[model samples]
Target: MKANLIRLGVDIGGTFTDVVLEKNGSSFSTKVLTTYAAPENAIIQGMHQVCAKAEIEPGAIDQIIHGTTLATNALIERRGAKTALITTEGFRDVIEMRTESRFEQYDLNLNLPEPLLPRQMRFTVKGRVDANGNVLVEIDKSEVETVVDQIAEAGFESVAVGLIHSYLNPAHEQLVRDVLAKKLPDVNVSISSEVSPQMREYERFNTVVANAYIKPLMASYLGRLEDRLCEEGVRCRIFLMHSGGGIISIQNAADFPVRLVESGPAGGAVFAAHIAARHKLDKVLSFDMGGTTAKICLIKNQTPKTSRVFEVARTYRFKKGSGMPISIPVIDMVEIGAGGGSLAYVDTMRQIRVGPESAGSEPGPACYGRGGERPGVTDADLVLGKLDPKNFAGGSITLHGEKSKSALMAHVGQALEMDPVEAAFGVAEVVDENMANAARVHAVENGEDLSEYSMIAFGGAAPLHAGRLCEKLGIERLLVPPGAGVGSAIGFLRAPFSFEANRSVYMKLSDFDSQKVKTLLCDLKREAAGFVRTCDEFSEILSEFKVYMRYSGQGWEIPVELTEEQAMNPDAVAFQVRFEDDYTKLFGRPVAGMDVEITVWSVNATTPSEKVEPVAATDGADTLVVNGARQLYDPATAKFVDAQVVPRDEMEEGQRTAGPAVITEEETTIIVPASRNAIRQPDGCIDVVTKE
Candidate 1:
């Protein structure tokens, strides 16, 4: 790595675009409202602002790393290109007919999420590939040409080819793509074997469809962004943050745009993991709240948990199987539309409910004075005196307290028959409880105890509510690191160039093929390494291996990590022992009579991570020096209190202040409740702990 290299990291959230410029070991950041029509406009705006703050020209920057929620938003809003899916004849409805499991088993009126492409848009051809990669029926060129002609007639911009058992054999899908390309050369194509290349036809098919769905949009956006940046005199390499918590070349990103889903939240998870490493915390709960969403991730041993498959735009909040599952490597987390812009309203039961819906940047929260009529969390925060009208977002956008009050009164107060302040309290309480409940559910699902973890809060809105969330979750320690407002953007700078490759080739313990396993792992390693090489050929690369294993009759598999030696010299007995150990830890015991089987194998290749030196724990000395005092709402007391307000940069290391205080910064504010005390750690992190 080059020392003192200037790099720019930009993250586009639902409501805000965060930009961080790191040059000469110093960091400068800025946040701007996201431009929905032209997302790159916001990036360029933020980039120029941060570049000015860093006292450097855009041309001086060495590299640009970006992450965005555009792909995810496009899927949720159904705003992508007119895409079609071409699959095996009999499996045309596989994506619609999901697995047998129901997210809400007892609800008679449960609504399953609709498939991305409608039935009319999905076309099929006559071809068959068996589970073992054997071709039962060769793909017919005439059939593929006919399907291509139909797709062209339908005006499809992109097509997804997902043949039955394509993960095992790609010949049939490749033939279809070849014919499609020959017949309709302008349309984009995505094949399941190349996109996912894993078992489970539904997930693989959906993954390819998603990739094709967003391919044209993302490709155009990236092209425009590059052109815009070049016009702004930025001449450097551009990389994209991927869902797997790594950086990939922009070309790679455009090709497999589905990998970029959840990229922004993945960066936040990476940020929390970095902080965890710095603090030497073994267990951490990462809480990131921005304008449009909140993400909760569990970090163990300084590494965020990863998943091979994660759902997007979940229709049923907190329900696992109620969303479209995209089988891609991703940083695991629970995301909810519970952010500053999350609209608050009263349900039929007269109970206040916070989002899944947000008044995004165009017409943001009522307090933003952006023509939003509905009451949102930001409006509530403003009404509750938790936000400074003149200081929010460095005063780039002024907030209107009166508007917030009126919105709250009209939306929530009237229904609940309460004053605006009381209604604001209700909105705030409901949103906070929603986040707390999400955190609890996530922790429980991971078999983790929240009490054993420290909370690392970031994003534009996390600090404002993290203390209250911590109090609710019974978490003792909270760390609000510097540049918390642009944490995800900064995280993009810290991410390594990496990629993960996975394939499914089943092997039972009784008939284990050591040579085949070795060959598979080697191939995966090479594939992953090839991707990393595109990003940085000179950087030393490292490989990590894992296998998804299960008992003979079980459907799902648990991931078991493996060493290079263990993977190369596969021993059935050793593999079973390791699987048993992990299964026992997860379920308390493993079945003794069942034989173990390996289903999917994975390899991750990456450049070296940035080294983080641990910060020594300090006993902060109490020194009450208040810069000012503000009338802040105390949730604990259910009333307003005169709380000391201090600028974050003004406090020295080891300085401590009691709760009922607000620590202000240019980007965000940290609210310390009356029951907790805030201290300045040596690393400039605001460490808040419960008062003894």
Candidate 2:
């Protein structure tokens, strides 16, 4: 690919649709209010504006990489198509009976998240495959035909097939897929063996049901988007970002939308990982605050940490194990509904609370003047003088500060008997505290310490809150990288074309079958390589092998790395050594004499990533003076202080600006308190270091 080949990346968020165009090593980005009815409208409108600014034709675009929250939003909002779940006879209620644990033990009135497929829609067939992949009970072909007829009569849009132990032997699943195509050619079908070929029936079944539940909707939307782009003279290939911080073909995405659930956050992690590599920061915490959510991810050694299973739409205020569990490779991060467009109001106990609820871009925060009466985090930001009235979103939409103030006053201020400014601070503090609490809990749960990690801030609203968040978390430094406004969109350009193939087959290290393992790994590698070959132009592909291992009695498994040579040879000692190494890194030690068994084997075939170098420092301790000063409330001091204001672009690398100061940019502003001193890094990042 030539440097002049225009590469466009579009990310659809809850509040804004971000577009980034890269050409000849330079990038141009813009944000527009997302169009809820037709998301492609926002993409076209934003693409037009950015292309006009760059003076390029749409036909010149060589590739378009996209990431979106639409699939996730639909799953969370319960707006996907009516779906049916078909499983083994005894596992009809697996999704509903999640984990058998209470997220909030003391809260007696807690409501559980509803299953995506209701009990009435969940049907089962008489099929059995033993744990060793032996066919104990054969599937009745006539029964499958009868089930298909019943599904057609029931007016279902999609179907999920999840037989017990199907991950080990997909013969029954493949038969169902073949029958599905012959019976109902248009309806989409997803199988657990294909969607999530891992053990644990609950997670695997839920993942397949989720895929089937959202298949029709995602397929229709993606088809329409592709058609619309073709109509707009864009002949480039479209790549979709996956939950694992990589790019895969559109066909793969459509076939398995479960892998796309965390795609948006994965992009943010990729963005932060790139910045960390450029700045040579070994420990970094990526903070991304969009319109509807805030995400916190940890990066080390220039790579984001990845997890095999994560929950979605937690019920008890984002509590773990209280939501739908999906088994797929995803970048590990903590996400909360604390963003600019998150709703703010008085709760049932007469306490002020911010979302979990969001007034999205359609009828955005009251400050946007888009027919919304609910006060939001953005409204409070405007009320507190953090946002520029005229230059918001580059002046795309004029903000009404008074309207925001009035809405906040009527909804929050009068109830608390405080003035609008104090109330505004309250809203901001609550949201900030919510984010801090989430980050703290996530770090502690993962056995990580945040004090030692630097912060990488992005998204439209992250920079505004990053400085303050660091102050609260006792974090010493922060990096607000270039293209901060649309960081995730730009990150799409850096993703690699890859796919991971996983399968479940219980085999103890003591009973290791080298021949069987070699054959299984070879088949999975070919399957994964076939997917990557569709989107990459490479002569060779690299393979990564891993196994999910755990003690015999343990309920869950931990992933451990396996070498190509080791995967072909049977050696219990080597397996134990690798498992112990990984276990010690995570939990500080491994239990002795515990028999470890491999539950799932995963192989990822990938194309190589482009080389990225660290940005060099331009050394000089220059002082950038403020244009003016303003009285702003500082939470650490718990009082109002005079803060200096400086434009972010005007301050060059190596410039020092002391707090209390406000660093303003086109997309967001950074507020530094008197307790912190900011030094501009060589890579144009503001490293806000603590002062003694």
Candidate 3:
């Protein structure tokens, strides 16, 4: 008999490698410092530890799902392969021209992010397809051979082909790809029609170029990971999380690597959604703070809000329009560099500024004793008495407090003429405020109010600073779920095997074609379902439809939900009614008599969500005793206070602990601030509520 079937989830973060093992009804997890050279080494080590504790062999694992920050890191570090872009002749300037909007309007020395491929690397071919899906200029086959020779001589590892209006007519793009394969079989190629089938030349070109830039890197890493896993006696299918909050097969992920840019953060959002569903919560703000960056995602009614386009590597201090736009389905969220390992420094303005630069796993933080001299947010937390130097990561790695103090005092303390402790508090507070402000801006931009949403804090550092952030945002309640350290990994297990299929099919509601729309929707359903079938063998599949619509002459589109029956029988009146309803809900009102047109259509097919019923309340202690007390700086009091420390496992269900407490777990710590109350929930979560 099989020893015991288990499902494993692994997340490789910038600071730590987290693994969660689910066998039968129980779960076990382990956290280890991430190895930068080979992230898979940390995963294998953590897996071995967790399985050993559970007394199971590696072969007993039935499935292993993984999420990683590698793709995002490659984009941020500019470590991807040398890439070339082939676009329509005149459209080579589109990526640099952008939308003619400035992210920073007043700065005279504003520096936009440099395009991934320079003008010389961005070549154009003799081909033109009009917006109406008509061939304006036939692609010159002879010209293609010359372009191929130039690209080959340029030593580009990959190439992106994006012709004018290729989303409407992909014939020329396909022919170019075929010729390139014939000329250079080893060169990775991506086309806009296949990578991002949408309007807007800049976004489509950026997406395809980004895909090409990362193709070689992702392909090599994925192949090595698969081989290593099989060598470790794990014979199971591997799936990767997509930015759309779904799991796709490795093949698909490799082909469209841009979709994997936000894949890890998307998993964290899914994990928070699952926890919200378990507690019957309708609105939640998922906060994930890892080592390299912090992300905030909003979930309402058990679904994370999805966006069709997102940016990568924001250059102007995380401002919109300062980054490359990639058209893909992704969970909408705001990501900033305020994570534990985010470096801090005093800028030219003599003001403290936290990162967009991080030490990552290689040097990590000064406290980790990894030869990092610059202070990080983690070292500051230690100096502020927020973290137990000896108890971090369940004592797997002991932090050097003196080193942390030295780094802080040498870098920030001396400049401000303040002691290390005060500087630490200042750093912590500033970073906390930065994250809170980002959360507020993101929510307001999406027309949401923080007071109406509960906060779900996860990741290694999120639980540490969540209470303070909640207070700053005026958020009343926060939930710290179990397995919070590897929340994204747990989310990978929760994600369903699904795929989103999108195509550019322009249609005006005023002159809608019901039969044509019906046929298109049917074809999309089959396309999406076929992709999902490759990952899951289940006989049942469910699908959802969406249409990207905009007013006539508008250059952008917003997503509108469509039911299966509605897609099959798209009546103009009914379509307008649904469109206006959604429009009014978002923008308060719709322009009457304005013609609406659908620019793109999308379909998502997936397995059903898993059922996780709420746990019933049980008789338990009302108050829990503390293990010890420590001096914690209370910002409200402007002084240090004696805070109680309690081990999370020792707290019984329904146990209540007042504010000024530190609940420690093996993976992370939960800090309940002075103005809040913490309660132990039935399902091993710490619920924090504001004081009346």
Candidate 4:
């Protein structure tokens, strides 16, 4: 919140660790290979590199805001600590018996994903809390103790306790935690009431289990990161980026690591929103393609769309209802396994299929010369001349073009009976089409048209492919902002301190009690504000209210936002009006003569967003800046074209360049497709637009 203070933003992705150091209003950044054995090692390496670039020591950093994909990775890889779950006696299989929804409805061989915890690992307690917070059956302390003893005998490092209806009456769940604390004090415990106080036993139980599964791993990493920073003479307070596009205290993040599952992509969304606000664009598509995954989100009114629940580790082609559902406040986006390091090979249909499998930094893309045999998206980019073999990562790492050619030939070309160049083209097009299709589907799901939206592309690999993606999606304008390669890390510095608290208390409008509604909202506000206060005690906090409402007999609900006055002054008529307005927008029209019901209430408390200086639009003189030329593969034409190569720093404000050009920066490169032109906007953003 103070000017001239040095701050550090670190994001650890599956393949790369990005660090940005901001000092005296200027920033320096660097990317390093992620160390899986010791993730913090990468952070330290990246931090030092940025510090050296800024001509400062690590000790000069006043604060650090970090986000990571480790938690999501743990859940995906199922390499977390050995964890057990305790639940109501009858609901032991809630997680395994997921709601009746099939991602693949007609595929009889649809292989359902295995639950996080096996039935043997999930022990049940004899306790019952009714829907109205009434105790139908008091929890037996002895039964919980017996379960705890079994858990200890089974050598579980962590425990999850999720009693039915615990969101209404957490007293039963607390007793189990108290018993665990007295017996297995070292074993970490996660309870549904504290982790996610929402309805639906399946999502609630799964969430707590996920939190418990990764709690120890995250806590250990955070502890080691703090110690390593302290060992380096850095005394700055540390914070963590959360999935809801906000910053939280490190302690809270460690306590509830599930909230950090989408943290990195969340930061990117925030960054895109910030850019959208500065450019005065209400409808923008956020495209973030990193080393391991690509995330696409839609921003309206400079705010990233938010969701209360999202799936993680979708086992069946990134389909809905195919992965473990995580119930937390998150930036809603569609993330697919398409990134620079995503591997490619010919499928059974003789089509190239790119990742959900990435050759991470250990043995990165084939072009990295890191012992990887399979060609990846990066390898394709290298073979296609989108990357410089000599100057990759600003010459920090040399790329081997021959290796890329060989891998592409062996993996894809040979199978498809094509040359290496054609194979590379196939791989690139497949990956780009995958991303484009994902963006289109996401937009359609939200009732939006891609043609009406501008694109904000970021992340390490996005700019290189964004132009072609724009072409495919029929998007007219694209903005590749400054520090685009490390946009998420930069976003950490721009986010506000905030937290969202959610509770599910089903109440039909016919039975709505205004006094009770006010009380419920107030309590949630306090709970969310308390978490934000732990991050920053001095900043003035603001509150946002939302409720999920649906007509009676509907399977799902739509989120309806409410102002402070409308929220505080509970009116059933007003609530119905708002709900119908949002429903009509989402669906074609609202059903008439149906009673509306509120399912979940959410309150987000956040500090004010940082003020931004707007950037004036720039129109360059009708001249091109052609510093040099190189052979670039044009995807639109499916052939090689001589393209201009211009260094980013040399492009002055309002300057322009024609299609088939490479606007190169130290961290990344922007490829202007044959159908587009590039403009250096006044704010250092390369604005790419359609030539027509």
Candidate 5:
């Protein structure tokens, strides 16, 4: 980014729409309640607010980067456009009949989610393409035209073409698309080969269906946003953050909105990775808790881990396989329905249970006084003295403590036969424990230890509970960076312009063909780099190569990275050695006799990463910062303690404060538990470490 160029980063979350404006190494940020009906309204409002703070006109903005949750929300709510799917005759049930394995093994009355398109909506054509890219059965033009006529008569807003083995050979799918375009020119179309060019009929078909489903919704929103921004005199090239922790041109984002499903969380991960680089931390845990959900990601060596697949809208208690799987490059993380607005209730087992449901910003938490009666995490925090009733959102939205107390008592206290404070404690503990368990599971899955990783907490609600969470996870240190509440928006600015191109070609190490491998890799590089060029025509682009490999009998594969040299000159022996090294690190050892096979190959082309200046730890003498004290609840001691209230802006460098304190800022507040102490670092980061 140019020092003098003004950049705007916007993140539309489930609850809040965050905006950040940056120029000449300075930034201004604001948080506004998300406008569900017109999410762009919030963005415009927040943009003006930040521009006012920065003392600049909206027209002065040089660029805009954005990420939104509309795609994920549309799929989760099942409220996308009326979509129809066309597939090979026999594979019509591929989406309906998901993988055989049940997410929960012992539940006898388990129920799988229904397919996105019902049987009536999913039409089949007589077409077949084998796994070897052979055209076994070609579709008759009249038959495709017949199917298209029915789709047009049914008034589908979007149509998805997903034939069997479309990833291997897209001719049939493309033919279907051509027929649809001729019949229904106005209707949107998405093909599996373009949305997700990979194997697995179920995943590929579902991915295309999802893209088509959300196509109209996202396209309309982006178009409206651009028009409105231009109308407001904001003349800037708009970019979008993709789920792979990078930026892409708006044109690319509009074509494949599924890539934006995890965009907001991906930006948060990028923000944490930037922090990790500045501090030179090898291992860091990124925790982001907003109003509707909480996300946890592991950052190692200043980069967030990447994955080719992840689930969205998990239907059963955030179970891995219970949600729609969209096969696209993304930052790997575990997100659960545990956030500020996550509602709470007493379960049938006489235990307090937190959310997979949220109150959202329309009604918000009970304390928001917007007609919501249920007690959520925000209500519990208010009852527990973790959030100030009068100072929330910089006093823009005043909270009602009595409303929270009443709601908590009615929903949880009476059922549990406990007081409001006790009920609030139960809810808070459950929320914290749920997030900790998720973090632990994610860490164990990746062969990591929580105790060895430092925590970087952000988002509007994370810092309030991060202290207690660190205690539970046995983490010793936490860093709350500036602009923590709007971390994702800031991350959007930090991300590079990039794209990942993926293809599935079944091959075994025993049949090593260097020439074929070289061609495939080169083609992938060109495809991925071409997308990046659309974002920045002149910036130097770097290519990253990876292969997903598994043993012959295994159902899944792990990603193994390869250098350009290694990819260009493929060797069977070298492939085995690299696969085994990564495999041994993950599973302790690799099988000696099993043959190794590659399922998917990927190439990511990205702009060169920005250089980072290491943060010099503040070594000046520590001075305690305390202006007043309030009765803040101490979860560890199960009692109320007089905690100091320190204004963050007034705190000087090297200033230190013991636990039982609250560091107050405009966008958020950091709660320092009694068991730990905090110090203001040279870079304006609040470092929270355990008391000696």
Candidate 6:
């Protein structure tokens, strides 16, 4: 760590922009509503607030690490620049066709997501590259010129070039980019080979298109943010958090904005991992609930699970293959629109249905007193006495209880023939069950049991329902760390400067090419390390290797970790043994006499994470006192009870508070349910456990 260095971390979410300033070891944080027109405005306001709290000037900041949902929102809302896709001849519809696998097999009326580029926007060139990196048909310059003319006439701001088998050879794609650049010098071009050098044309093509779609927007926003920060006298290097839970330079982020799709949620997972390391927990689930979405990630051995492919804007709530797939490294998690601002209403079945729709920052919830008339989860929370209307968001915005009641009664209560409080209970129950179902599905898909894992809750809205969620999931322990409301921002500070580079190269174990494998691994390491070097010049960059392996006829592959030495010196026997071991772990047993094939190889270059001292376990809890009391709804008893309300700042290590209680903080509040007790652990974490 640099001595006396001041680091600033900002996370722009759907509803709020969180800013955290760390000087020496102490930290100051603040949350402000996100400005949809210009996100940097919120960041600037939040920075000023945190700086004032820290009693420092903006110029004193040494570094700024940022994570945002802008790129994701742009793609989901279709607000990106006018973009076009160029692909190999006869393959223009690959993105729309989408592998022929239906997520809803029984439903004949299943609706697939539309491609990012329509048929008119997707153009094809006469060029071919074989799977073995052989050029079957050379590029035609005149044909490229014709496409370039059409693109120029269409006023496209960005173009995506994705030819068949371009992952193996980029010659054709490069030619198209070169020709297009020569003709349209200002347009941004993204090639599949450079953006996602992996197999599967549909995924690779869609990934590049997504990258191209958001490139101009992210680049302009980042440039504007840089200029504004400079005007505020903050002279420091800026980095962005990617979806893989690592930090990359602003230029790299701008170049491949698709990598930032889950950046904010990835930070929350990183924060949970850090807390897990401190507590020495091997299995933990990260629960992050912000204003617009709730994310659940499984953390094992103090590291969040990572995946190569991630889907965004899922049309079907919990079903896979119903969204736009982006083949980029990302922290694996399940996200649902079950947040504080998620709107709630009664459906035709006379049942309460919570969102996939959010009010966001413009109207926020009914309690925000904005123009929104629909009741949201936050409004329900306020009506249930789980949130204080006067002290919400640090008193920056006073919530209106009357507005919340009116909205709930009009939208949900009247339909269900219940009062506002009863309607609020129904809404809260539906949202909580929605989140719980998502978590359960995620765990079941991963073949894990929720009872064995501890839950780490963060983000602004997580604590308010974490205890109840744990009760629903049969989870015994829950940890809410310090700065839980701005956890993602703090995670931006803790993340390492790193990057992962991967490529697809098929090789069977029986016909292992040692030299070729070594070469591929070496190239991947160099590529990953090169990006990391841009962020940290002197820190040691550690390399981690993984290969995707599966049976010869399997559709998908499983990741098998490889040591640096194993990757450098390929041993067929050792590789097979590791593959079988991992395969057995996932499927209970490996297939006998079946040849194993490797499809993709990956190398992650990262700086070593900061070390954390483990917290010593305690045997007995100390006595506690009730600071105050408030009427809180108890779902189990279906009534309101006077619960102890305590300020978080006043609690010390080893202090204990019995449930039904509410632990209040400036950023958020933790509601200890009637069945659980809250204890302040040694590491400044509130440990909520079921009462015996």
TM-score to true structure, per model: 0.99, 0.97, 0.97, 0.99, 0.99, 0.99
* Steric collisions counted per model: 0, 0, 0, 0, 0, 0
Q: How many backbone clashes does candidate 2 have?
A: 0
* TM-score of candidate 3 to 2 decimals: 0.97
Candidate 5 lDDT, 283-368, residue by residue in tens: 99999999999999999999999998899888989998999989999999999999999999999998999998999998899999
RMSD of 2: 1.7
Clashing pairs for predicted structure model 5, backbone only: none
Q: Rate the local accuracy (lDDT) of all candidates.
A: 0.92, 0.87, 0.88, 0.93, 0.92, 0.94
lDDT of 4 at 314: 98
Per-residue accuracy of model 6 over 1-692 as CA lDDT, tens digit each: 36578999999999999999999799999999999999999999999999999999999999999999999999999999999999999998999999999998899898888999899999998978888889999989999999999999999999999999988998888889999889999999999999999999999999999999999999999999999999999989999999999999999999999999999999999999999999999999999999999999999999999999989999986578999999999999999999899999888889999998999999889889889899999999998899988898898989999999999999999988999999999999999999999999999989899999999999999999999999999999999999999999999999999899999988999999999999999999999999999999988899999999999999999999999999999999999999999988878998999999999999999999988899985533785796599999999999999999999998888888889999999899999998988889888899998888
> Per the 3 Å backbone cut-off, how many clashing residue pairs does candidate 3 have?
0
- Candidate 3 lDDT over residue span 1-692, tens digit each: 13355888888877788899989877889888888787788988998998998899988888887787788788877889999998889888888888888899999898878888788889888878888889988999889989999999989999999998998899999999998999999999999998998888889998899899999999988888888888999888778888999888888888888888888899999999999999888989999999889999999998999999899889898899998888998999999998999998877776778887887777888999989998999998887677898888888778898998898888888888878887788788889999999998999888899989899999999999999999999889899998898899999988888889898888898889888888888888999999889888764789999998888998777889988888878788888888888888889999987999998899999888877898664333487777688887787786889899888898888988888988888888898998988888899888998876
Cα misplacement distance, residue 231 of candidate 4 (Å): 0.5
lDDT of 2 by residue, 148-259 (tens): 8899999999999998998889999888888888999988899998899888888999999989988888898889989999999998888899998888989888999888
What's the lDDT for residue 424 in model 1? 95
As for lDDT, the candidate ahead, 1 or 4, is 4
Pairs with backbone N, CA or C atoms under 3 Å apart (clashes), candidate 4? none
Better of 1 and 6 by lDDT: 6
